[model samples]
Target: MVPLLKRFTVFNLAQCEGLDRLAPEPAPLPERQIIPAAEALIDATGADFRIGGERAFYAPGPDFIQVPPQPAFREQINYYRTCFHELAHWTGHRARLDRDLSGWRGGPAYAREELVAEMGSAFVCAAKGVVPTVRHADYLGSWLDVLREDNRAIFRAASQASKAADFLLAFEGAPEGQPAAARQSHSSVQERIAA
Candidate 1:
């Protein structure tokens, strides 16, 4: 007869002699270096950044990004992540990507814009070798409701997000011969939305 093996959802290694040695210890968080590519991309936008506040936001009227100071974050990477998210919103300025930024908080339009920002930030973070996390968990319900209402909502949001990411990334190591306006003119936000 074959010997039986037992499975466990929770196991106590200390219950068995010498089994404690086999238990794995938790790993430490890796030290991540600041991404210069992300920095260059942000600088290229020429968007004003105010870096000392409790909340993070992109003010489209003035075309500025405000983020809490670096020291306020538990992990330095989170600070950059927040900045990238706001920068995604900054791309929607009338002079840039020309997205609809007039949505009020807790509304459908707001949820859609938040989705774009979240995905846009993920794209930029991935390009810069940084992991992305959801910055707006409270919007989860609203996002789901929007998705449930329209089958194509996600596709539109994704297309818009890709455009936003591309716009920001274009600023990184831009060619000296091309002016910023000319670079931004290559894609029309309205045309993309209509597709």
Candidate 2:
């Protein structure tokens, strides 16, 4: 048995910002509709994606991405984030963009590649109307180390990320109400942003 507190704890509700009232939950999309949109987006890139029990990864040998089953993520969005990250790596496969994917972990090359993948993921998320969040905040130190080592490192990574995003989104066809010239100009603006 445990002793009970003599007084009840209290919080000053007025001081609590944004919690005065409960916000309504978003209307949930059907699972079948949700999964296929992302799946089709991935499939459109011509890369094989599979569900696995292990940690997610992009296997270069067979050019496929292995993601843990949907249940592995706390939220549906997280699974897609992981998928986009791995798919960014998939863009580096020899038959694709051909990046130097042979780097060992903890090496400078590995750090650079990780930077590319992360930025690429962010770009893809933004394109797909998903707000980007830092999925691997722990890797910030490694990324900072890489950036400190090379002045142009971030530029190159951003350019590659933009290209990876463009490559993936291209399969979705044109954006509604946007003309081809506008799209091309937007890409040019993105390239300027890299500079």
Candidate 3:
């Protein structure tokens, strides 16, 4: 069991303008530290990530994720990256962040959700010292379509992804030098999302 962020936490968006203004970037953690930190965060979510499936998906009703095992991936990092992507979807469960997950596969809403998961996974990987790859690079055309249709699409996706990352990182052992303003901004965004 890991530490949990206070549920229903309140944050102020106006004060978050300085979120990314940390004086100096913190030193990266050793490679060995990354996996364990990711595992801890996944564990903290209380969602089961099963390895028996060939396709990866988040089951909102069950509050669980299914991903293919390590051998199914081209690299070890990919396995966990996919896991985090699915975990981002897990955050959208009704009891968690409560995002709308009713879109059909390959639909506009699906592409939007994919954007959130990819960005959220990148944020989590960066937090844990893992360099993230564009796992869903094939989705770029669809993503661009969405962005073209709405100027604020990327902004909303990034904001939602940040909130998903913050929600999971709340279980990590330490804060990893993330600015309080940034964390608070993420919380504020989460509050907005839930509303």
Candidate 4:
């Protein structure tokens, strides 16, 4: 059986900062490699995405991943990765992993989750037969700056990545272990986070 945590394992390999807190355990979540049911996850989550359109839309739920729209397939993939990243963030919702996206929307909390999801999406893309972005130089400056400010931000990212992975895994009828962090009871990650 494919372990659901590999989604997180891939995030860790991408250097997700915060999950370090959970490292002492032996199983050590799965890595960036494809788990047994990657396709199942794609289907179960109803994660089908459109190729071209406007940048943003109003969705009633906070589980939507917002991507900047464009024409290039490359841009499409970038946004696709970003959308997965946001979906990764939304996975932490109270009904699911219950991550606090609301409190940290535009702040460091939000950025940290973005980083985790960014890495997680890259990992998932690779496993699902797409290429991971190599233009991380574009992200390093801001990411490092954020990391410098929040000592524990990495930990939060790790937890969020695991939560995202759990969310993906749940789609496959996989087991979900409670993430290391306690989720906020009320509010969506979006309502708590950004515009």
Could you tell me every candidate's TM-score relative to the true structure? 0.69, 0.66, 0.67, 0.52
Query: lDDT tens string, model 2, 1-195?
Result: 458847767878666779846656666544522555665576556557788766888887878889987665556676777888898898787655678889836677787888888888877776676653445545545586766968888788877877777666765664443434233544554465457
How many clashing residue pairs, candidate 3?
A: 0
Alpha-carbon runs more than 4 Å astray in model 4: 1-40, 47-53, 56-62, 66-72, 134-141, 173-195
TM-score (C-alpha, index-matched) for candidate 4? 0.52
lDDT of 1 by residue, 1-195 (tens): 447976658756776787765777866545554677666666666678998868999888878899987666677777777888898898888877888989946677887888888778878888887764444445444585766777777788888889988777766655543447535644653455457
lDDT of 3 by residue, 28-116 (tens): 43333247767666665556778776788887776778987656554667767777888889877776677778873777787778889
> Which has the better TM-score: candidate 2, or candidate 4?
2
Once fitted onto the true fold, the runs of candidate 2 whose alpha carbons sit more than 4 angstroms away are 1-37, 132-142, 174-195
Query: Which 10-residue window in model 1 sums to the lowest lDDT?
Result: 132-141
Top-down TM-score ranking: 1, 3, 2, 4
Question: 2 or 4, which is superior by lDDT?
Answer: 2
- Predicted structure with the largest lDDT when compared to the true one: 1
Structure candidate 3, residue pairs in collision: none
Candidate 4, residues 1-195, lDDT tens digits: the string is 676755433343447666667656565323333333443554455433443455532131544444444333243445445555555655655665565666464666666756776655655655455553545435634775767867777666765565465455445443233222223321233333322
RMSD of each: 12.3, 12.4, 22.0, 21.4
- Candidate of highest TM-score: 1
Per-residue lDDT of 97 in model 3: 75
RMSD over all Cα atoms, model 1: 12.3
